[model samples]
Target: MLWTITIACLLLAGLIFRQSFRKRNEEIEMAGDAGLAILEFGRAFPGEAIRAVISTANGRTVFLRLHDGKAGCMNAHGHHYSCHLIEPGMVHVTGAGPKRLNVKFSNAAFEGGMFEFRDEKEAAEVSLWLLGSFMPGLAAQNPRIVGQPG
Candidate 1:
């Protein structure tokens, strides 16, 4: 009886360890894929990428900065997320004109691991407009904008 119990416990421990490893792998995979997608889809960004922020109704600010700004956050399960980034504006001085640019965004809320794109097409349209303003040449050339079907 003692040996049987010991064997069963060992098997259970091994199973648990396997599950842990699997979960870790899944997380890494999701992150890698997400990074690549963002990099590819958002390559038009000049200088550096920034994060955006969004305030939930409950006052729980789900960190949206990572989608574009600094200190961006991604949903642990990759469900609903958003971020922002600030690019150099036309008028370059403190309050000279439209001094700073603040672009906000949110990713499509996916179910489980499946991502959602509420209006990627519309977002892409806007993305192109802004990118063109800040980075005309590159934005025009890159395939991230609508004119180029970004």
Candidate 2:
């Protein structure tokens, strides 16, 4: 009777452990997929149109450039993503390295940390988006408003 009880307890514990491990792995896998990130963000904010997506090297964060000259980010929090549309004066960014940036958010709920991009250009591009100075195709259309603050 003692042997059977011990084996049952061990089996239960193993099952619990396996479930927890699987949940964590699922979160990691979801975080790595840019399409999933974009889908989640879109679900959260259906009105926003995303122009470009920049996934970090750690696969935990995805930065988005909106079609209307806005910036946004999706951060993985456990099984769900915390999506935020970055407004003007809401964020501050500084370069940590050629391919890394230190982001600070005005909102206390949003945690800021070091974001490492895939390359220097991506890092620079995100920085420009955060700074509210990145308007690629829009700039060519309106040369008079170039360098003007929104």
Candidate 3:
């Protein structure tokens, strides 16, 4: 009776471990597929490829990519997502910390939403790219303002 009980316990433990491993693999696969879809549909960002992906604990994901030496960002929320060119007037930094960074979008549906990074280094890096490179370039490309006083 003792041997039978021990053997059953071992088998149950092995089964639980296998299940957990499978779940982790599924999550990884989902993330990879999500990244690929973003890349394929990101035609507005010609010649760009996903360089990094940041995921939040609350299930939001952001993709960073570069094209012709400029940076752009894309946001994915669960099964629905959108990509945008980082225009000068579109994004702004709202908060900062060693383990957190907050940015707000002006024209995006995600306006007022804060993007959380794992650490200050990552946050700073992204902020600099957005502010120093992306936004400025976006402004340079903008057409003249319409219909206001000369």
TM-score of each: 0.33, 0.73, 0.55
**36-95, model 2: which lDDT tens digit per residue?**
988999999999889889989888899998876678898997768999888667787888
Write candidate 1's Cα lDDT for 53-87 as tens digits.
Answer: 33222221222323221232233435223333324
Which stretch of 10 consecutive residues in model 3 shows the poorest summed lDDT?
A: 139-148
Q: Candidate 3: deviation at residue 73, Å?
A: 2.1
- The prediction achieving the highest lDDT against the true structure is 2
Record all residue pairs in model 2 with backbone atoms less than 3 Å apart, i.e. clashing. Answer: none
Clashes of each: 20, 0, 1
Q: Give me the displacement of residue 149 in model 3, in angstroms.
A: 42
What is each predicted model's overall lDDT from 0 to 1?
Answer: 0.38, 0.84, 0.58
Which runs in model 1 stand beyond 4 Å of their true positions?
34-150
lDDT of 3: 0.58
Estimate the Cα RMSD of every predicted model relative to the unseen true structure.
13.9, 4.7, 7.7
Number of the candidate with higher lDDT, 1 or 2: 2
Which candidate, 1 or 2, has the higher TM-score?
2
